[model samples]
Target: MKPRTILLSLMSYLAVTATAIAAPEYSVDHGSYNFGTVTQGKKVQHSFTIKNNGDATLQIKQLTASCGCTAATPSASSIAPGKSAEIKVVFDSTNFSGKVQKTVAMTTNAGKNPNYTFTMEGIVAEELQATPRQISLGTMKAGVPREVTVTVRNNGSTMHRLISATANSNSLQITPKIPKQNIKPGESGTVELTIASRSEARILSGYLHIVTDNPQKKEITIPIYGSAAK
Candidate 1:
């Protein structure tokens, strides 16, 4: 091989290596968080550390949340090489219940993998909770009435009232007419759900919507599942 060709090949290799080393890199110390369980209408917050692991500065172009209940903000828009920044994330549990998960995405000017998503997951405990959460009316003969009861407990510090109960399907009915029941704090009350039974046997599936006086949850649903045998 000629010495000229070998020198040119070496120079090209050095140039590629230098370019790769001079690019920015985005590194997250922790990309996921689990907040366990929190009461409804509570706000939870966490901070994630981000570092620039390359020779060039890392620029955070945009930050977005998956839902309006979540908010994210970065302490610095640009991170110096080998330096760290904090990304503060907040989640509001006012409109959430049961198990929930939310995400926050970050767009950066990094050489590789510029886009990243962070996840926050946990459970939200409601102030007024039903014992079974859902009701199974069970299999019964067509045109035979069936009844099931749900116990609503007030775990909060305020009065919990069942304003009204409505069944979505005609196959079910809320007994006791209006179902107006007031539950004192740290007490419990019962709401009766009756399946009125349809003439034609088929799958029975719908939700029992319950209106509550609780501010955090104005309305709650209890899924109903059953079948009427012909």
Candidate 2:
């Protein structure tokens, strides 16, 4: 064959190779998120769906969550023919206040559209306002009921409950009475506590756990430092 003819054939092969190779297709269900309202020092999570729209299987090369406080995970490594997968995103609300929005980036097998981005948004509230974050119970005798008042007020207008209160050990018991377990906005109440140390639980110096909507400041294991009978 002549050299001119060979050169013409080589040019035609290069043109056909470029046109025949197709790019991959990656599809994400949603691109943005809004948590509406979240409490400070709390955790929020959301799941995103991913589907394949191209002619070939979808392989996820890597994923980069928006921030260090955020986490992202997938249900599977690869998507089968005409199938789908899930991506889970979790946001940590700590040292943050008010409105917040974040994003996550994903890389796939596509040539033209190899990456996709998603988002998460929310609002955080301040710690539950109160006179003191801690309380102290003076000295007491065993088998005697000791009561104390925990002055608490909800700073926000939102309806919330103190949820539940507990003791770290069996040496004490807490009963949130008066308003009898419910307190409205700007309302005042007393959590009647009964700290009766067991005959064996002498000389008590333990803690109690208080859970509330205020995650950052929800738990207050105030010191119950005192002495019990022998």
Candidate 3:
């Protein structure tokens, strides 16, 4: 090869390497956070700091949460080189119980690393808890009525009242079997639910909403699933 050609090729390679090195890069202070334990019907939030480690500006294109119960926001849409910004993630525990984990995703203009994700996890404690959480009637013949009982217990420190019980579907009926409307702390009661399908065979699915005096868990849902056979 000619000497002039080799010199030009080396110059081109150096320029490409410099441009690649100057591209924007993203670095997060932490990848995951644990909130430990939270009460139901409350909201929790955490902030994650992100730094731009490269020579170019970092442009955040979008931020998204995993579900409707979660939300995320960034402090700035763009960050200058060597600067940092914050991303806040909030989780609503109104419809969640037990252990839960949620994530927030960020899309940025960083060349090599364009996407980042942060996670938050915790356990939710409810004032009232229902056993089985869900009821499955299996396969049932059409026009036949099936019954199942769910045990409702008060897990809180104070006594609570069973205000009412309702089913979303007209084909299902709910009955509270507890002798007294008010239940002492740590006590339990039963709810009897009857599900029936009329003339047609189809999939039966509905929710049982139970109203209680517990402030945090005022309404509890019990999912019902079954198939009506012809």
Count of backbone clashes for each model?
0, 1, 0
Report lDDT (Cα) of residue 38, candidate 2. Answer: 70
* Candidate 2 residue-wise lDDT, 1-230, digit = tens: 99999999999998778656644577777778788887667788999998877656788888798789899998886886578889888998876667888888898987678888889988876445443445555556666777676665654556556766766655655454434445566664445566665667655666656667554666545566666654
Of candidates 2 and 1, the better by lDDT: 1
TM-score of 1: 0.73
List model 3 lDDT by residue over 93-212, tens digit each. 988889999998899999898998899999987767788798888887776777778778776677888888878754444444444567777888777766776555477777888888
By TM-score rank, best first, the candidates go 1, 3, 2
Q: What's the lDDT for residue 110 in model 1?
A: 93
Go through the candidates in order and give the C-alpha RMSD of each one to the true structure.
4.8, 8.7, 5.8
Give the higher-lDDT candidate: 2 or 3: 3
Candidate 3 off by > 4 Å: 1-21, 135-149, 156-159, 166-175, 183-209, 215-217, 221-230
149, model 1: CA deviation in Å? 0.6
Off by over 4 Å in 2: 1-22, 129-215, 218-230
Compare the candidates by TM-score and give the number of the best one: 1
Winner of 1 and 3 under TM-score: 1
- Candidate whose lDDT is highest: 1
The 10-residue segment of model 3 with minimum total lDDT is 170-179
lDDT of 1 by residue, 1-230 (tens): 89999999999999999977797897898799999998899899999999999899899999999999999999999999999999999999998789999999999999888999999999998888887888777776765677677788887887878898877876654453334488998888877766766666478777878888887888878888788776
TM-score of each: 0.73, 0.51, 0.68
